[model samples]
Every structure is written in C-alpha cells, then in structure tokens.
Target: MENRPKVGIGVIIIKGNKILLGKRKNTHGEGSWCYPGGHLEFGESWEECSRREVWEEVGIQIKNLRFGTITNDIFENEHKHYITISMISDYESGEVKLMEPDKFDKWEWFEWDKLPSPLFLPTINQLKEGFNPF
Candidate 1:
C-alpha cells in the first residue's frame, strides 16, 4: 500500500485571554473538546479552507488568519493519520451556533490556563508548545 499524508487545518480563535473550543459531535474523537477545524478539501487553499471550516463548524468569520503550527499524527492501531496546519485568528463576525449539530455538542470559551483536561491529544500538545498560559 502507498502512504499518503492527510492534510487538515485548525483555527485558534483567541479573544482577550480565552480561546474558543468545540465539543466534537462526530464519531472520530466524538465527545472530545477541540479547536475549530477540519480536513482540507481537494483544491482548496489553506486560508480558504481554514476560514470556511471555522465558519461551518463554529458559525463565525475569522480575520488575521496566520500560520501557527503543524502536527503530524500517526495512529498505531487504525493506520489513520493527519498533518494538521493550525492558524491563529480573530473573531470577525457572526453569532455562535451549532451549524453541524451532529458533529459538535457545544461550544465554549476557556482561559488557556484553565482549560479542561482530556482534550484531544494533538490540541493539548499544541497548546503546550504554542500558547503561554499566563
């Protein structure tokens, strides 16, 4: 079998000292709290995909999108993986709504230092590496 990298994107929507997080509603990592993002669809630019995903999943428009981090995840059991490119963005417009109700149960803003535990592993790691709690 040939190996191919799965490309995905994540948006870190920061407002003051808190960050936006979504409780996943879909099967893969369902019930896990994560950043707003999803797979990069074919032929879509990273910026476009990032903005689209943030809007679709969280119902908000994003501005000042900038490169953040890239995570390469390799699962041992399922042979599933992802190469996630993350970005930092400011909230531009729109009210919070569950656009994909089945994919996410809820949305909340949390202080970085006080984020709930057991967050999606990659997101947790990214937080540690890229964000300063204080």
Candidate 2:
C-alpha cells in the first residue's frame, strides 16, 4: 500500500507509573515493541481510532486522549509510508489480552524510562521527535 502516506494511530496508554506496550508479530514491525494502536479508519476521528485500536489489540480501554505527537514513518524495506498520529491516554478499564494474537505476541507495561528493546520504527521515531508520556 504505497500509493500515498496512510494515517495510523499509536496510543500510549498511561498507568500510575507505566505505559502499555505490545510486541509486534506477523506484520511490518514484527518482533518490535510498540504502543497499542492501528491504522485510522475511514470516517473515524483520531480519538476514536486511539480507543478502538487499544481495545481491538489489547482488550483494554483508554481515556483522556490527547495529542502527543506525529511522525512521518517510511518503511523502506516494506515500501510503505505512514503519518503516525500519536495519542496519549490514561488507562481506562479492562484487562489486557492478546485480542489479535496474530498481530502481537504479548502485552506488557513498562516504565517510561525503562522500555523494552527493538522498538517499532514509528515508536523510535516518536522518541526521536521528543514526545514523552512522562
């Protein structure tokens, strides 16, 4: 899907002292850690996409959604480019689960200063963009 830059939503769900992340599987960023998120659907708002992706991927809900930052991530190897809409949100409810096991290996929470290795490209770009949840 390289016709043009597609829009994606990457939500950083914040807890008391940690945030939710998932290990990518069977996709572009396979084996890399990333925030709970997915592509922006047609006729949907960014806020809606943030909550939807989190629930769809991790079986959890998020609130207080606010703009975090944006990244123009170009996956050269996959020949795909995306304008990632980063959303910062507070953990709302529900237990985290591998709702889409095929897309993610497992879900985990990590301190802002202590994250897992091999972050997804869009995630790495978010950090490079100076966007912080803490």
Candidate 3:
C-alpha cells in the first residue's frame, strides 16, 4: 500500500440560519453527522469537486459557492489528510436525498445553535472557529 496525504473538499450549504448535514453510514463513526463533501478527482478544480461532491452525496445542485475553510490533520501516526478547501453556498436546488444510500443514512437541515452532538471533527472545528479562506 502507498502512503500519502489524502485531500478532500466539502461545503457548508447555508439556507437561512440552517446548514445541511448528512448522517454517516457504514464507517467507524456510523450515524455521526457531517457536511456534504468528499475526495477530489484527479485534475478536477476545487469548485468543481465541491459541486460534484454535494451532488454526489446529497443529490442537490448548489450555486454561489464561495470559499470558507481549510483543515489539516494527521491520524494514527502515519495517516495524514488535508481538506484543502470548504465552500459555502447560499443557493441549492432539488429535494434532499441520499445519493450514496449506504454511505449516508440520512440527511437533515439544522440550526447552527442546535447542531447534533459529536459532529465530524473537522466540520465541528470549522463551525466553532469560523475559518477564513483568504
């Protein structure tokens, strides 16, 4: 097996005072909540990846996406990861549905003040600290 830092992109899809979250499925953190996102494809732009991830994970099309945050982490001594960028979008179209039904158990919109406990760590950090991607 090869070792390399995995890179990903995510988005905080905003609507009014709420954000969209997906319930994770089939992983160690099964049932934990997280924003919509995933790994970038080879040669894909960040914006394109973000849009693709949102659609792939949530079955929605988003617009007015803007940069929000970047996160870096190292895990279990050897596994490293970088969330190169996270975008926030004000507009989304289509009914909410799980594109990868096995990967995500469900989806919901939640008020920021009333988010579920034990969110995906990187997302929780970004929400708490208000990251600026300048």
Best by lDDT: 2
| Per-residue lDDT over 10-96 for candidate 2, one digit per residue giving the tens place of the 0 to 100 score | 999999999988999899988999998888999999999888888788888788999988899999999889999889999988998
Clashing pairs in 1: 25-103
For all predictions, the C-alpha RMSD in Å is: 2.1, 1.2, 2.8
CA RMSD (A), model 1: 2.1
> With candidate 2 superimposed using the best TM-score fit, by how many Å does residue 130's alpha carbon deviate from the native?
2.0
Clash pairs, model 3 backbone: none
Better of 2 and 3 by TM-score: 2
**lDDT (Cα atoms) of all candidates against the true structure:** 0.80, 0.89, 0.77
Question: Comparing 1 and 3 by TM-score, which wins?
Answer: 1
Q: Give TM per candidate.
A: 0.87, 0.95, 0.85
**What is the lDDT ranking, best to worst?**
2, 1, 3
Cα miss at 118, model 1 (Å)?
1.7
- Give the C-alpha lDDT of model 3: 0.77
**Residue 23 in model 1: shift from native, Å?**
0.8
